[model samples]
Target: MIGDSGAKSLSEGMTSMHELTHLDLSHNNIGHTGAERLSEVMRSMDGLMFLDLSLNKIGDNGAECLSEGMRSMHGLTHLDLSHINIEDSAAARLSDVMRSMDGLTHLDLSHNNIVDCGAKSLSEVMRSMHGLTHLDLSHNNIGDSGAKSLREGMRSMHGLTHLDISDNKIGDSGAESLSEVMRSMDGLTHLDLSHNNIGDSGA
Candidate 1:
C-alpha cells in the first residue's frame, strides 16, 4: 500500500499532468487527507473521464473531498469507489455532487457500509443521471425502504442497461419494489439480485 503520504505525493505530481484522462489508485492506503490533496488536482482535469479508487479505506471524510473534486470534472463518465468504507453520510455527500453529472455512464459502489439512508441518497441522485448505463450497489446493507427509494429513482433511468444490487439485506418487499421498477425500464439488459432474501412471491 502506498499510504496517504504516497497519495499526497502523487497528487502533487498529478497537478502537472493536464492531459490525463484516466486515474486509478486502487489498493492504495489513501484516506481523507490524501483524498483532499488529490481533489485539488482533480479540479484541474476537466477532461478526465475515468476515476477508480477501489479497495482503499477512504470513509465518509474522503467521500467529502472527492465530492468536491467531482464538481469540476464534468467529463467524467465512469466512477468506481467499491470497498472504501463509505457509509450513509459519504453516500449522501457523493450523491449531492453527482446530481450535475448527467453524462456519467457507469458508477460502482459495491461492498461498503451503505444502509437505507445511503441508498436513499444514491437513489435520489440517480434520478437525474439518465445517461447511466451501469450501476452497482451490491453487498451493502440496504433494506425495503431503500429498495423502494431506489425503485423510484430507477424510473427515470431509462438509459441504464445493467443494474446490480446483489448480496444486500433486501427481502420480499424490496424485491417487489425492484420488480415493479424493472417493468418500466425497457432498456435494462442485465439485473443481478442473487444472494439476497427474495422469495417466490417477489420473484
Candidate 2:
C-alpha cells in the first residue's frame, strides 16, 4: 500500500530524473495528499510521454492538484486516470490541464463519476486534441445531451481509430448521435457501446 507517504518519498527521489518518459503508479492507494506531492515534481518532467494513475483514490481535489502539475507537460502522449474517483466538479479544471496536453493521442477516463456536465466540459477541450486516436469513457453517467456535445467536440478527430462509451446512461437518442459522429470519423475502427439502452431504432 504505497500511500501518501510513499508517494512523497517517490517524488523526492525522482526530483532529479527530469528526463524520465514513462511513469505508472496505478493501484497505489494514493490520495489527494499524495497527488499533491507528485504534482510538485511533475513540473520538471518535460520528457514525460506516458502516465498511468489509474485505480487510485484521487478524487476531485487530487485531480486538480495533478492538473496543476501537468500544465507544462506538453509532450505527454498518453494519460490514464481511470477509476480515480474523479467527479464532475473536477472536469472543468481537468479540461484546462488537457489544453497543454494537445499532443496526447490516448486518453482514458472510464469508470468515474463524470455525468453530462462533466462530459460536456471534457469534450470541449478534446476538440483541440486533433492528434487523439484513442478515447475511453465507459462506465459513466453521460446521457443524450452529453453524447451530442461529445459528438460536436469529436468532429475534428479524423485520426481517431478507437472509442469506447459503454455502460453509461445513453439511450436511443445518444446512440444515434454517436453513430452519426462515428460514421464521419474516417479512421475509426473500433467502437464499444454495450450495456447501454440503445434500441433497434438507434442501432
Candidate 3:
C-alpha cells in the first residue's frame, strides 16, 4: 500500500532493480507531479502486471501522463484508477492505451466525473479489448446517453463477467440500455445497478 509519502519518493524516478510485478498506490493525495513521476518508472518495470492508483487526486493531466506511459507497458493485466478526476480527454487517451493492452483483464474507472463523451471513448476501447473481465463505472455522472453507448460497445465483449454501474444518475433509458447488454453478454455473472433512477417505468 503506497501512501501519499511513498508516492513522493516514486516521483524521483527511483527504479527498482528487481523486476516489480505489482504496485498499489491507492488512497494517496499525490497529484499530477507524483503521477507523472510514476509514469516515468512504469517503462522500466517490464514485468509489472498489476497497478492500482485508486482514490488519488490525479486529474486529467496525470491520467494523460499515465496513458502515455502505458503505450509501452504490454504486460499490465489489471489496472485500478477509481475516484480519480480523469475527465473526457484523459479517458480518450486511456482508451487508446486500452486498445494496445492485450493483457488487461480488469479495469476500474468508477466514481469519476466522466460524462457521456468519456463513456463513449471508453466504450470504443472496450470494443477491442476482449480480455477484460471486470469493469466498474459506479458513481460517475453517465446518464442514459452514455449507457447506450456502453451497451453498443459491450455487445462485442463476450469475455466480461462482472460489471458495476450503481449509484449513478442513470434513468429509465439507461436501464433499458443495460438490459440490452445483459441480454447479449451471457458471460456476465454479476451486475449492480442499485441506487439508480431506473424506476418502475423501465422495468
TM-score of each: 0.96, 0.97, 0.91
The best-first sequence of candidates by TM-score reads 2, 1, 3
| TM-score winner | 2
- Model with the higher lDDT, candidate 1 or 3: 1
Candidate 1 per-residue lDDT, tens place, 1-203, comes to 88889989898888788898998999998988988888888888888899999999888898889889889788889999999999999999999988878789999999999999999998898888889999999999999899999998888888889999999989999999988889878888899999988888878
Note each model's CA RMSD in angstroms. 1.1, 0.9, 2.0
The local lDDT score (0 to 100) that residue 18 gets in candidate 3 is: 38
**What is the lDDT ranking, best to worst?**
2, 1, 3
lDDT of each: 0.90, 0.92, 0.84
Which one is best on lDDT? 2
Identify the runs in model 3 with alpha carbons over 4 angstroms from their true place.
Answer: 1-8, 11-13, 16-18
lDDT of 1 at 3: 85
Q: Could you give candidate 3's per-residue lDDT for residues 3-30 as a string of tens digits?
A: 4456668655457533778888888786
Tell me the lDDT of model 3 at 142.
Answer: 88
Cα-based RMSD of candidate 1: 1.1
Give the distance in Å from residue 106's predicted Cα in candidate 3 to where it truly belongs.
0.8
Off by over 4 Å in 2: none
